[model samples]
Target: MTNGTRTALATALLLAVTAIPTSAVAAPEAAHIEGRLPSGATYLMDVPADWNGTVLLFSHGYRPMGAPNPAQNAPDDTTKALLLDRGYALIGSSYASSGWAVTDAVPDQLATLSVFKDRFGTARRTIAWGQSYGGLVTTAIAERAARRIDGSLAMCGLVHGGVANWNNTLDPVFAVRTLLAPDTDVPLTGFEDQAEATAAAGTLTAAADAAQKTTTGRARLALAAALHNIPVWNDPSQTRPAATDWEAQQANQFPALRGLIQLPAFSWRQEAETRAGGNMSWNTGVDYARLLGQSSVRKEVTELYKKAGLSLGKDLATLNKAPRISADASAMAWMSRTSAFTGKLTKPQLDIHTTGDALVPVQTESALKRAVTAAGSAPMLRQAYTDNAGHCTFSPAEQLSALHTLEDRLTTGRWTGTDPDSLNSRAAKADPTTPARYVPYRPAPYPRPYDLAHPADGR
Candidate 1:
């Protein structure tokens, strides 16, 4: 499929120069193919001539419901070229649909693998890897489809499970409604459509923007952000704010919090509710005070409250007494069945995240570790972090280094050189031009963990 244009062009160029010997003819190049699955999801694949008996099955993150559904083979072209040059086959699918696609992604990925084997022959090893929401899909495959693959890598993933993720997102959003726009009757959940959700998001975001003008509003915003564990560092190019710099910290967190409320908490929640058949998130009986106490930015919130001359106790009391949102049992059940993680890792898994990701907080890593430890599969999972300030902000060199590390573990049945220093060193060797900053980090506890094990934590 790939030889027609290139072969003809090369032949023309060769004839223009001189007659080429028949012995000098080259083999046709590998084909890049695209096709759709029975579920209507499209997939892309690249198989090199120097096949290495290994296939890197990639899973992409969420796309908005209305966006184009194009198949992606890797996170970027550089990574794709690097892997293809090194003889690793690459393939990925655009899930059957988008927006909170956890329900369809996992199965579509396994189906893609089935097609890959049928078309390219059975691979000696298959490593599942993904970013963002796809990271959750990769981890879920590690737990549920263990027999089908060798190992997995998840970057910037929401491994804390869907229920917990939405609850954590809802906490700060609920706070924004209760504390700042108490008089505004915005539907915090059960959004009827995108327009409805967007309208609600606009109302809440305007409330947050106006609140930023006053010390009281800023303090309350900080509290709400803390409730969801939004990072104090938002801009990647700017220097990180000092630990005690309350104003700068709040200033940075304000944008991140606003973005989360508009997208994940409202707009994306609408998609999730639609897919799950009803509202699948809740904050009934949640202790906002306790949730703040568990937040990494608790001290910042307190300092801001003090500077604002706001009675922190009174605000907490008001939030505690606010009417709470409830979840539909059937919707919650659907999400749990499809999106919750059991952490029963039957194969080795490696996960990486950016330190200052606002969309999916680094604290979710702590929750993932807890789940794996509970399942007694801690030995099968290893996590690393990059000291960057955005979601999935990984360099091609860093990504190649991670792929090599997982490959080594799978080949040797032992984990080695997985430490931050070793990882950075390998990344430097992979590409000296790109910077890599793998750091040893322990994320704070997820403020409002609400999975199967921590079901009551939401209460």
Candidate 2:
């Protein structure tokens, strides 16, 4: 939170210690190394007694700007034990600072591998793996690191690209500001500081809550969620709501929806704009009618608006008539150069997603698939899905099975046991103690994906 603490994150000067238990899983016989890079990028490493010769460079997802940055070797404490006990060398960094800091995180994470090699010797293979924003970082590193990294595993990731992810979010936030709470001075693009973003999120959440009680409001909320492809069943531990259970579903997902969409992607805008040096997101040329028509949930929005006795067209007209937001050309170029993905992958990569990820919708997986196809690197990619809700809510078995799938391709020069049935079986057969829950489901492409359609056009 403090500049002093944030700066400490980039200082990587770790020391080795015996592995200690952090979760239900027993600690493995491994050396736990802790250090910081010259840039204050703190790191953590785990080398099992019988090292597997391969290292997993674990890149973590976005952390709020003011949150503490700690070295992460796994997605969770339980995962730390799993990766280490499985005989895989693991290393990660706190990444200088947090909050949409992919630019810093990518290089800091890549630099971590060098520190690992210098201290513990070079690994025979290095696989990059991450979740959420880290997933996007893994994809970027995979594209750029190329021959240096052997494989990648992205779970519930934002591989849809950097600015592409945040910029598209503006669609939903713009809808909220224009349709639901026009009077609220919530800055959809720029933020003076973290508090401004935080305060705006509170205002948007209140608006979402009030709007959910009425037909037109519900219709508008549906439109906003559709534009962002945000799922309705958002509770972390709940199953997908039945179709007739619309009220419950809306209530369940609204908080996450506002946090994810209406409030600058959980107020990461302050930090994001800082990195981009200005407003890097825009919706000036976005045609609401076209976007609504192209949306994955368009049918649902149509039904909602029809049931509300309102014309969806009129609302879209309102959006089109409202003054559109634009971006600074310099900032636009910065985000695209740094945040957008070129899809130039040189190694095999696997993406794991849950069908109902509320934050980074499963639709992003499809967008990334398109990007890979455009780059003619489709041969190097594989995707797996689970019928679950919540972001990065993967079971240990599912997680380990995904890792095995990536490692499988790296070793055999071919993919095996990656289909739904096979992957479910693999997950079921994964760790005896850590049970598995893998369901088969295919995700539809994101409907409001301007980033995927026009990589250079600011969304």
Candidate 3:
């Protein structure tokens, strides 16, 4: 069977499986609050009647523009109601824009909190919960509002600034090869002339520009193919290939031909590149004008290359060898600057990630763990990993377990004991035949006990 047919079959099977009804967990009843922020922007919130001192402020992953409605697939309502049922107030907002404009959600979130206080009285403790891009917002919020918020839960959040976190997961050489020559399996055959490569790069960029205008899932898939030269409509039977193989295939396929594929698997690559390249650059310009710290230069360099049709393999090598600490130092500095926020969180925090999450790989979690650990509050943080595909979807038990863990932390300010094996057991069950290893958490020891007590103090 062709790769496309396999993908279709697999997708059909998935839809079939989801359609099969298992017992639906009863969701809690909550008051849906809709109002305009003080800034005149409209927003939505799910506030439950059961009054607890804690407010659960959730930030969603990426979504199209507009407030979430019942028909939408947003987990915000469900998550809000779930927390409300557990005795915490739930609040969130419809940020101004979609795409990378999620940074705007931070102020909207704060406005929601202000509204929650007016309607239900001030929360004694506020916990910020964000998933994916929501996680990025959560990090930003935690940084600015550490004193206002007691604790925070960042699930599969992007911890590093300026760089697309996922770009670090793949081999740099493969990244360059995939973008420059999608149809040919050749090793870094040296950089093509900038003018010629940029023209071809423009074709891929145009495809990406077109993809962004589309809202349909199919268009998303097409955009992925056109920009990244990846086959979205591939055989489902083909298990996840190694990164090397994936890159080789992309390098071998021409962007034009790959763009013609019926499915939009290639859209993700375009999205990734576009994000790493254009959107992030725009964000830096905005933040810098506001005198906010600049994002990592490493991330900027990666995006600059993609935008200018430069080769990743050669550029990364050049940056790494440069005397100015532009490459490695930038990422490290960004993490260090953000480290101050990790100390401000007083509430119990739980970070849940899937070991086999293809979209946001396990290494992203590792980077976050390293950042938290370096900040000197490792014990305060609890991480749980599932062997699941996609993003945060988990089995009923897994979901309940995570909710319960969050509930325990919110109410008692203490995390349940870390059961490394039990935490990873679900992911293990999903793929029993494979010998996948769990990367255990290893934190650097703190020099003084006070580091744990006072995270705000400079190390």
Candidate 4:
């Protein structure tokens, strides 16, 4: 698997990876197809030698707004090989555009499926799956494209609508601005273009970095992270933070907090605003004190503030008294109409998220669960978690295991062996290259844009 490796077909990738089988199982004759849609979107399709008639559509996460969209045919090279070896067809698109793409992805993916059908004929079943922002796309298809897709698997999803997700991300940035750098002049919202966004990100990121060096600054950062339910342990290479690792955890948490400033606050939100035709997130009338109290790390923040002899209450009170960010009414309307999941799931869905994911927090699962419940599709949805840090950092085994779980639910018309122990066993049996990391965990409720017309509006 050298980076320069290629096939007889144009730019066809032959994955040289450890987790994938060295050779196709039973020497199945698979058809590897690649092409471009009329809309200028590239796509890849894999029809297994066995032809099980079940196709898996993979949607990718956010790419920088201006980057070229790379056509994605599967979740990853390893997972693609595993699915192909097991006889499942795979198809996906690069999407017509990138960055905060939920607006375009839903239809683009449906179009990809349509193109797939035109080329390959009808399928017996179709499964939609994706990671990170694509996870949001997967959920959108699950709810809106029910007649076409049979089941969905969302890994490390931002299933909470664009409004709630971005607004929550703004929590820490807002805190750093209002409490620590009120006079820093960083534009918190309403970016006119990419340059303004990048500049603001630099300003906020520097403020966060400087403030994290002091106790009170750490407390305020913690408070904002809590509001967004940002996890403490963010590096995938590191183990979970122990109770005694409070400072170590905060140290680890700082970069993730900075990431919120740079990526979500600066880049993602502006892209979302482009989709919304205005601003769709607002923190008007938000009660910061109540949000802090409900956070999972309330104890830790309290400890940090106590050690610094700073009054957590005073900061909370300060936030409450300060002017809040508000969404443009038209933009709010656009986002509500175009960027949310109303649950209303017509097919089964299995969502897997990491416990300590910094980009798309584990609490996202909680947010989606409530949305599905409100849609009366609660019984149609199931969730799984892994004790991992980082965003969409699941091992290959974790990915296939979640797909298997969804397939099982679809087959049985009921959930089977879904507990952490059961899922771990299944994952071990499925993929020998890696061990299962499934764990039973429930994340805290979402903490921003507190309420909405859609259940995904708030966790």
Candidate 5:
């Protein structure tokens, strides 16, 4: 199918899948659920009347995990229903903000799992499955809930910190910095300084205010662009429709446009307005730029600069002359020190990635393998790589293989899988017409505990 056709079909399939009711297929017996960590946060888990001992607690990707909000595309209710039909008691936590607050979510997940087990009395064997950010959350839970969780099925998950997976890099601050640094040649210092100045002058706030005041479509476009680092037309004199003006231009374009904007190399250019441009759409291209020029966006740009050690009032000349610091303080803070993945893995784990996943690169699996090895937990690691677009864009065969791997680990307490190198090579040899199969699971020899290996915490 053509790319456009594929996208359209995918969108339709997504809508259809999410619209279907879980109750339609093997309705779950309602069970009382309660939250131990986040007071009063609770939900009803419908354990399938014919559920087997296998209980699958889903950790949704990048959204509110345990919340009672209606399921959307991806790991929604329909997906949960499918697992239910497979004889697994499906449990989900109404985790705060889909459990973005990791510290809070961890305790809540354990508590909810406990509630499910106590209420149902059948959750002897448990498997945690999560996609993307949900994968990270799942790993976190697995690391802590080693005694309770039998195995984990993580798709497009960063076994380590999400930031570390250069493939699955999600932080907008990093994405914007990387993109703008190359184009401007002004050293991030200049952008940071401009942001500080804009913040002090209230330039961004004023622009946001102006966009809010005006009913023009261009204004709304400008506001969003500014807020999200959409590159603006360097020539401010260019005229365009207000953002609000084209709000309904192409009804189905917004979500896809937003998804595109999230990509690492997504550039907002003025020339994109022309019809000859291949990938850029007029509304997305124009609004992206206008939003880039907003004051609020500038402030964020400045914040990243500051985080990177470029102080306010520092000229580009000074920043350019400064040495590239060895220790990225921000990275250290968000990743190494506080990150849950910094520790060793105690249980069997499987990580899945896609070679063509534009958002999160396949290299991330290697990076994670190296990081875990470096941390002295190689024995528990296994990875599977697929040659598909986006995260978890695996064929049905690939998904089945992953499911089988999870079942093996849970049932037999052993993971047999090939390493990443072989998987990558095999994927390269496969034709696009052929469905990718799981490169057999091969567990690495477990390394001695970090403390035992180095005696000084492997510093």
Candidate 6:
């Protein structure tokens, strides 16, 4: 999209009017506000007539560099309408740029809040929230912008931080390239441009697609997915596979495996490299066998290999023998600086995740939990899970219920109705038609967790 068109889309919420159905709480009349920040980011805001003295600052997730940039003030249209109906103000920015945008998103969101306060006065309370990459941005704000926001919500976020997230992400793509297409020449990092990245991704994806047809290929794919922490259940419409059904589980993981290699592995990696000035990911001294052993899916991988009449040991040896990739120190430092999570929260933060999110796997919560505990901020954080497949697929009832629960904590100075049963009950009250799937869950430790504290190649 052209720069002008992108700006227009970002400001469209304030420039346009929509007819809201009277059925949803009489469709509160709202005042639209739009502006451009000094950083050149476009922002949009909506405030209802009966203002609730609360504001939600939204930080959107990664958008590919070539895609259209539209400002998202809420996770979805239904959520936006419900927030407005409840007399809450909503605001967000397009961000300075997209694709792994936490660097720009945090500042842009905070700047939008500054603008809102200057225009309408300080809100009684503000909550920062976002999904995917935006979730990381929200966490950063919760850490650094405590004076500005009262609380925060992160949905299917990469809270483990960019350095950790991308490092683990590299593990799977490396496995795919080394095992599935050893003869093919597709660079994993430091791409010349999006065109080069896209081409490499296409080649890798095609290799994965072809590999899925053979038993040996399926076994290798399972190993790659395990390294990536990709969940076995990807299709929300399909029933989750039985734990011991290795065949069905591998089948479910194949699509996520292919998509992960294409997007974050190649396309997103290129964008991140350009922004960071060089390669920020490495596998220089990684032990493929030990990494697989640490994975929750290791048993599944072992079973799949046995069934395929292949030796897992041989493949691991091959992977170990392959040449390792190294990161530029400056680039690695840049990524960590912009995206690392300090886990020092001065305000309450609630993170929600689907148990089977393939993109930002639920294991990310484990890493974040470790950081928060180490930082002595565990009491300020609560993570809830849904027994569902796919990414950020929470029902409207669930979404609203989470916000209400967080708001209750902010108002009462104590957390209540946060357990699965209570959360489900609250969601039922919000919308009885949609079933609430909140369940007690504890994610296993991430297999290839990496952060500044545990730098790659021992830094």
Specify the highest-TM-score model's number. 1
Q: Which scores higher on TM-score, 2 or 4?
A: 4
Local error of candidate 4 at residue 34 (angstroms): 1.8
Worst 10 residues of 6 by lDDT: 449-458
lDDT tens string, model 1, 1-459? 478989999989988768767678887577688999999999999999887889999999878889887888799888788889889899999999988887688899999999999988899999999999989999889888999999999999989999888778788888899999999999988888989999999999999999999999999999998887778885687579998999999999988898897788888899999999998888887888888888888999999999999999999999999999898889888888889887678899999998988888899998888888877889999999998898888998899889899989998999998999999999998878787899989898887564554445443
TM-score, each model? Answer: 0.92, 0.88, 0.54, 0.91, 0.52, 0.91
Local accuracy of candidate 4 as per-residue lDDT tens digits, 1-459: 554553433244333333468575467477877787777777878898898989999999889787878889787788788888898999998987888766678887898899889978899989999988899899889877889999999989888877677677767788889988888778788999878999999987888888888988888888777777777787876667788667776777777888778887888788878777877777886788887877877787888888888988888888988888888888877776666667788889998988888888787777788777876888988999998878888888888888888888999899987899888888887897886899978888777532243544423
RMSD of model 3, in Å?
A: 19.0
Q: Candidates 3 and 4: which is better by lDDT?
A: 4
Better of 3 and 6 by TM-score: 6
Better of 1 and 2 by TM-score: 1
RMSD of 5: 19.6
lDDT of 2 by residue, 177-196 (tens): 89999887677767777777
Which parts of model 5 have CA positions greater than 4 angstroms off? 1-37, 40-44, 64-78, 98-100, 162-337, 395-397, 417-459
Q: Could you tell me which 10 consecutive residues in candidate 1 have the lowest summed lDDT?
A: 450-459
TM-score of 2: 0.88
Tens digits of per-residue lDDT, candidate 6, 1-459, equal 999998999788555544445475565466898778888888999999898999999988888987988777899988888788888999999998888777788888989999999988999999998888889889999988899999999999989988778788888888999999999888988899989999999998999999999999999999999997778786797668898999999998888888887788888889899989999988888888998887868899999999999999999999999999889999988987888876778899999999989999999999888788877888999999998999999888898889999999999998898899999999999878776999999988876565444433246
lDDT of 5 by residue, 245-266 (tens): 2332212122222343332212
Superposed by TM-score, candidate 5 places the C-alpha of residue 72 at a distance from the truth, in angstroms, of: 8.9
How much does candidate 6 score in TM-score?
Answer: 0.91
Off by over 4 Å in 1: 1-28, 452-459
Candidate 2 stretches with Cα past 4 Å from truth are: 1-29, 261-263, 433-440, 448-459
Residue 325 of model 3, lDDT score = 11
Alpha carbon lDDT of each predicted model: 0.88, 0.80, 0.46, 0.81, 0.46, 0.87
